[model samples]
Target: MAVAQPKIDLAESLLSRHAAPGPGARWAQEARAAAAARLRAMGAPVRRDEYWKYTDPARLTAAELAPAAPLEPEKEALYGDRAQLKLVFVDGVLDADASDALALDGLTVEPLARALATDIHWARDLYGVLEARGQDPVPRPLAALNTAVAGQGVAIRVSARVATPVTIVNRQRAADSDVVLHHLILLEDGAEMTLLEAGPAGARYNTCLEVDLGRGAQFHHVRTQGRDNERHAITHSFARLAAEASFKAFTLTVNGVLTRNESVIEFTGDDAKAHVAGAAAGDGRFHHDDTVFVTHDGVNCESRQVFKKVLRNGALGVFQGKILVRPGAQQTDGYQISQALLLDEDSQFLAKPELEIYADDVACSHGSTVGAIDEDAMFYLTSRGVSKPDAQDMLVLAFLDEAIQEIEDDALADGMRERLAGWLARRR
Candidate 1:
């Protein structure tokens, strides 16, 4: 007879030891335990999983990072020279001493644990609803691990008719530790808010954000990730839009050992619209991937996705986008485009844009292109006496400029452009 292998009761073990139950940590413990059970039942994802085939989660997640250690003086310098509303979280705890941005009138920025401690309704409503829509059989191990030990994160809510924007800055200190999951929740109805996110940590960090938009609500979310070469970062953002609500997002990834970002938006009511765009620059041995899923469950919803990538050396780039139209989603207009220019043959990219529609009246389209630097354009510029490196950088900026300009904040857009040029110059 074959020997019996030991089975691990992960849920019970985590609940008994790692569960941080407190005033603000209300249902977190229970939800975490439940998620642990789900993960245990499903096991870790392998090469066979469809969504995870290209990127191997087994090697990346073989060891769980501990809570981040305290920040050193040099690590603190990472957050320097950025103008935005800042919310600093050290380790798994929010750093109240480092923030100076006061909450504006009609706006609330509090700790997620605090909100649940006083009243747990909001936390309960948002955490587990979206898991039902995606029919994938495998349990998300990363998500489960995140929920299991999610310490304190930030939360912001805008009252009706409020127009002020809130910026949340997340920083990680350098220290060998288990993974840190940053959970953020944003709520707006008849209100307009913008989130300017800054992450300049040189440590391993994992972040998760969930946003809910009520009727007529508008949001502008911008995220910047600039870390050192040793850090590994993963971020997931989920949004639910009501009737006529508008959602806009811009993401910038500059430096990291491995960085992956996932954005999923659901049109829960009719007439909702979403605009998403991002720019990523990676060089050397770095790897970056941006995956998105836009689902239309109601009638007359609109969505547009545009992603640009600048890769050099032996770096790898991946972009996967899917647009799904449910059975009764009539009059849906969905468009997606992913384009990348490889600076050399060693650099690589993988782009897959997919569409699934059940309604005959819907219009959905997707296109992807990967090519070398345009020689014609290079010649046109060089004929004017521009250097080879300068010409290549110009074409790259022009290619990515379309999406960068979509950002309404002039200051942020210009800052991103300047940084993009700088990165290209350094690589050259």
Candidate 2:
């Protein structure tokens, strides 16, 4: 009998096909090669992997690409009225022709390909360094693959406070496109910025973003992932914070065929703070997952995680979050909560929340809940002359409002609220 290939070996085999080296400078080439080697050593995630047990990895790791049509989202503009700088990308390649001026007054934007050149840049040092550091305690083969084969992306550096938000808009056009993009962002000491993003890139894509915040720096990110429900994506955001630095990120996901967003953060300086929140909605045949890991190594640091998801029509939602407090992390305050609303009997939600603390004195807590909609509230709304569909939607949006309100900026928060309302309108 011919021996069947082991699942681990098969997984590695599939990743190898996507590992062919791309053109770049010697340093960039070497970095990619090293990352690819690490990915092979770690092997691709399979159903056997504990972290991937809830969702099948076969769809994401298959050797052949899936066919997908480009999406036009004229009606899905979330921040259309905002007067912020804009950068455009098509199929993961920076569309210079479509983007505004590359050089702003206080910041510089350049293609990530420059890191491959002989001239040394901060990006060259950070290209895959943060992702490599995050591999410990958990192996991320996808992140490693991105470092090794990412074809195009952008490099942004901020030295002063940016009054205008910078938006990265993605547009996909081609069937069966496979896009790998790696983004690098550096915020110097005392710098601040707000990043706005909206779009669905392609049928299949892998994206890795690395952000390094210097002492006393601040970074705010708000994103919407509602358009083009057919896209499948795997994304990783790795962030490192210095003393007194702040990082806040919020994501609003509409329905999608498959999506897994992972965020990993580490506090290396004392008094640093980080907050992450997400609100997602799904219909039948949709699958969305959020996996987050936050580590507190600095004394007096604080972190928070709040996630809310709504699923109906047999859709599936997943959340896996953890907070780790190192030995020296006394006076640390960490909180986490994950909750879901199942609108129908067929809808499903799966969540895993954790806390690992080695510190002697620290306050850390986590909570998870899954339940159906409240009939009493529904009855009250309907009795007030509100139709059932509208009443249910109002309740659903109210459930998501808590997470959305976390955005500090009033304008940004209002924009997100409008998007949520539009989403409910479409569902109606």
Could you tell me the lDDT of residue 298 within candidate 1?
81
Cα lDDT computed for each candidate against the true fold: 0.70, 0.84
Query: Positional deviation of 387 in candidate 1, in angstroms?
Result: 1.0
**Model 1 Cα lDDT, one tens digit per residue, 293-338:** 8999888999989888888888888888989898999999999989
Could you give the C-alpha RMSD of every candidate to the true structure, in order shown? 3.9, 2.5
- Name the top lDDT candidate: 2
User: What lDDT is reached at residue 236 by model 1?
Assistant: 74
- All candidates: TM-score: 0.88, 0.95
Q: Model 2, range 98-131, lDDT digits (tens) per residue? A: 8888877667778887655645777877889899
Candidate 1 lDDT (Cα, 0 to 1)? 0.70
